[model samples]
Target: MASALCCRARSVSSPILSSARIRRRLPLVGAFCVISLGLSNLCPSLSFKTGCAQSLPFVPLFKSKFSSQSQAKSSGSIRMASESNTVPSIVVYVTVPNKEEGKKLAESLVREKLAACVNRVPGIESVYQWQGEVQTDAEELLIIKTRESLLEALKEHVKANHPYDVPEVIALPITGGSTAYLEWLKNSTRD
Candidate 1:
């Protein structure tokens, strides 16, 4: 086993093996030292790799088990709650085939109070598989900001106005934001 490892190391271009490459071959440096020491007694040539392996420090391959509460208490850190009870406002992303449709949809959503703001991002190129065929087209992307409660109505509005059979309407939650902006976003949307 030691002969094969030594041969593999020697066969490579570099005369001296790097510490990273050595660590990859042998998980524990100490275990490799013991095995190589025993093999060196049988064959004197294996002693060089044993000397090289001992110089590199052992790196932990896995993370240690720890509790967040205990770690916080020890370090004098304040840990925030992982989950909150209040429903947050979110940004809805929608893609339309053209700018006209995008503008119409954006205006309608904001006018209806389904969204507080709608930003039209033009010249978006989309490539996706549709009905078992790969298709590519220039598109306009709408970034709509609104409350979670108005999501159903917003979807219905888009469905009614959208030309495509299956439109891209997806909501992503806003975990946190500027306090004033969040407050304004909440106030601007429908009750």
Candidate 2:
């Protein structure tokens, strides 16, 4: 059962990594995931289903339908496992006054290779103080995904293209993700 669980945890149906290849390529991650899975069963409260089961090691246990971490967190999307290591990815969160502007910025980032992917979520209501005045507005959120090294460049690009005098550009490190997806992320963005 433990071996099967490990196999399942690392399973990614890619042409490059068949089940056998995954096990061979990531033996340690697979073993670690299997151990974690066993422990989770022992302690039901230890479950945090972060979509692709980053807790387990060989690879992602599964994938999530949603791509944006901020949106997913806001919606209580999934409960992921807890043992996964932080990957070298960063998620940049930016807010725009409207969806159209958000779309433009998102497209620009991806097109410029500053971001691997950008998820724009509309209808988000934001309330904050700006220039000593309380402000409220319906806003759009842009979740940008890319390698951590691109943060500086991404920030510069956003500052240049963003319409707001001070747009919210926050980033959180990607602690865990599917091995294949992370590889894709690395491949998609500039070094």
Candidate 3:
């Protein structure tokens, strides 16, 4: 059965199975060869030459998908998270002393292309310890959306511009959201 599949695979010469397509599908072919033929060893090479699988040790099909180094060595045939076309987005939480400060920071961030959108929530009460005493104060919250890669720059900008000595700059990864909004967020922020 494995030999028949291999023979059929080898005999396939359609225009649809061009070199680029073959390279893109090599992992699937390698997986089929390993599972169907019970082959313990196969080549890591992406070539489709006859008898190539039997000549070398098996290469895990999913390795390159998870490892950047492996993906780099594989000539980028497989796409990883870092190599994705869409930029990874993040949500940042920053608390400001008042609405005036919040607006100031939000405007600056958007104007500088560090943040896509900055939603200001007013009249929030924060209770925290400061200078060996518990303090309570009303604060404004700035919810910022931007690219994950811009986190450090955003944080630095906040630290430099924010009124607080230690400004609240908390970041959270955006797992999923509207595709259009995410794309807009990606486009709004710097690379």
Candidate that would win on TM-score = 2
Considering every candidate listed, which one attains the maximal lDDT?
Answer: 3
Candidate 3 lDDT tens digits, 1-191:
54555456667877765555655676786677665433222223443444654554544442333355544645543223335455888899999999899999999999999999999999999999999999999999999999999999999999999999999999998765566677788888888
Better of 1 and 2 by TM-score: 2
- Clashing residue pairs in candidate 1 are none
Cα lDDT of model 2 by residue, 74-113, tens digit: 3342223122222378899999989789989999998988
Per-model TM against the reference: 0.56, 0.58, 0.56
CA error at residue 58 for candidate 2, angstroms: 33
Worst lDDT run of 10 residues, candidate 2, spans 77-86
Q: Assess each prediction's global lDDT (C-alpha) against the native.
A: 0.74, 0.74, 0.77
Off by over 4 Å in 2: 1-87
Please provide, for model 1 over 1-191, each residue's C-alpha lDDT reduced to its tens digit, 9 standing for 90 to 100.
65567567766777478544764767576576655554544444434553554444531211123333344543442112113322378899999999899999999998888988999999999999998999999999999999888899999999999999999999998766555666677777788
True-structure lDDT of candidate 1: 0.74
Give candidate 2's TM-score: 0.58
Question: Per-prediction count of colliding residue pairs?
Answer: 0, 8, 3
Better of 1 and 3 by lDDT: 3
